[model samples]
Target: MIGRLNHVAIAVPDLNSAMAMYRETLGADVAEPFDQPEHGVTVVFITLPNTKIELIHPLGDDSPINNFLAKNPDGGIHHMCYEVGDIIAARDQLIANGARVLGNGEPKIGAHGKPVLFLHPKDFNGTLIELEQV
Candidate 1:
């Protein structure tokens, strides 16, 4: 029940450096940093021909991205987001299939202002998977 690849999220310790690298060095079309308090992250999207790359940085000490950066100082891929036609249906299907959904198994408003849910990393080959309603 997943559609196209929505975006690949990468956790970075330094948001400014990352943005400069993507915009100046790589010459990519990057969006301005958006502070998502609910998600506890300041994010920017690097646009691509087919998909987008989400650069995420911790918004506070309690942010999940802070923990991720602590584990990997250099920072790396945090999650991969895939689009779904219907988030609720997709969530039910994943649950019925014995897949573990993260964070109370409810959909949250994502960066795109779309419904989004995260599945357990272990269930998806050690990679965090985010399902976003298209």
Candidate 2:
């Protein structure tokens, strides 16, 4: 089952501008940008008191963020990540409950370097959900 809210991911057209908004304007403690080639995104984490905000930009033309940005030029919230005690067990239970897992239905290393899986947006009331192992 899902645990605490891990982070909320937002796709941005310009990562630098987004970083400045969070760092300079909001005066938030933002981490340095990290390029996740495997995930096809360049990301930065804006640490909040209780959770984190992840600003992500497309890494390449084929990146999924590209399509997202194309659909909404201003960019917006892409997904919400929740923590899980056991990712494998959580995955099985979700699947048995008729929830569809994205991609190959296997866990992948997320931006936090933790095992993560994405569930279909339709299964979760139109919002994409990410389950990360705590």
Candidate 3:
């Protein structure tokens, strides 16, 4: 089952501008930009008291974020991540419940270096859901 809210991911067309808006304008603590070539994104986290905000930008033309940005030029919330005690168990539960997992239905290393899996957006009220193992 899902645990605490891990982070809310936002797709952004411009990483630098988004980072500045959170760091300078909002006076938030922003982490350094991390390039995730495997995920095809360059991401930065805006640390907060309770949870974190993830700013994601396309790393290449083939990046999924690029397609998202193309659909919404201003960008928008891409996904919401929730923590889980056991990723495999959670995945099985979701599958048993008829929830579809994205990709090959396997966990991948996320930005926090934790195992993560993405669920189909339609299965979760049109919002992409990411389950990360705590």
Candidate 4:
């Protein structure tokens, strides 16, 4: 089952501008950009009192963010991540409940260095859901 809200991921065409908007304009605490070549994204985390905001940009032409950005040039919310106590158990439960997992239905190392799995957007009311082990 899902736990606390981990973070909300936003796809951005420009990582620098997005980081500045959050850090300088909104007066938020932004972390340095981290490249995730395996995930094909470069991410910047904006920490908050309760949760974090993830700014994601394409790392290469084949990055999934590229497709997302192509769909919406202005970029938008890409996914919402929720914490889970046991990722494998949660995954099995979701599968048993007729939910589809993205990719090969296995957990991958996320930006936080935690095991994470993505669920199909259609299964979650058109919003992509990410389950990260806490």
Local accuracy of candidate 3 as per-residue lDDT tens digits, 14-93: 88899989999999999999899999999999989999999999997789788789899999999999999999999999
Per-candidate TM-score against the hidden true structure: 0.97, 0.97, 0.97, 0.97
lDDT of 1: 0.94
Error of 2 at 19 (Å): 0.9
Question: lDDT by residue for model 1 over 1-134, one digit each (tens)?
Answer: 68899999999988899999999999999999999999999999999999999999999778988878989999999999999999999999999999999999889999999999999999999999999998
Model 4 agreement with the true structure over 40-103: per-residue lDDT tens digits: 9999989999999999999977898888899999989999999999999999999999999999
Q: Which candidate gets the maximum lDDT versus the true structure?
A: 2
Candidate 2 lDDT over residue span 26-91, tens digit each: 999999998999999999999999999999999977897888899999999999999999999999
Model 4 spans > 4 angstroms off:
none
- Would you give me the overall lDDT of model 2? 0.94
RMSD value for candidate 1: 0.8
- Report, for every candidate in turn, its global Cα lDDT versus the true structure: 0.94, 0.94, 0.94, 0.94
Model 3 TM: 0.97
Cα error, candidate 4, residue 27 (Å): 1.0
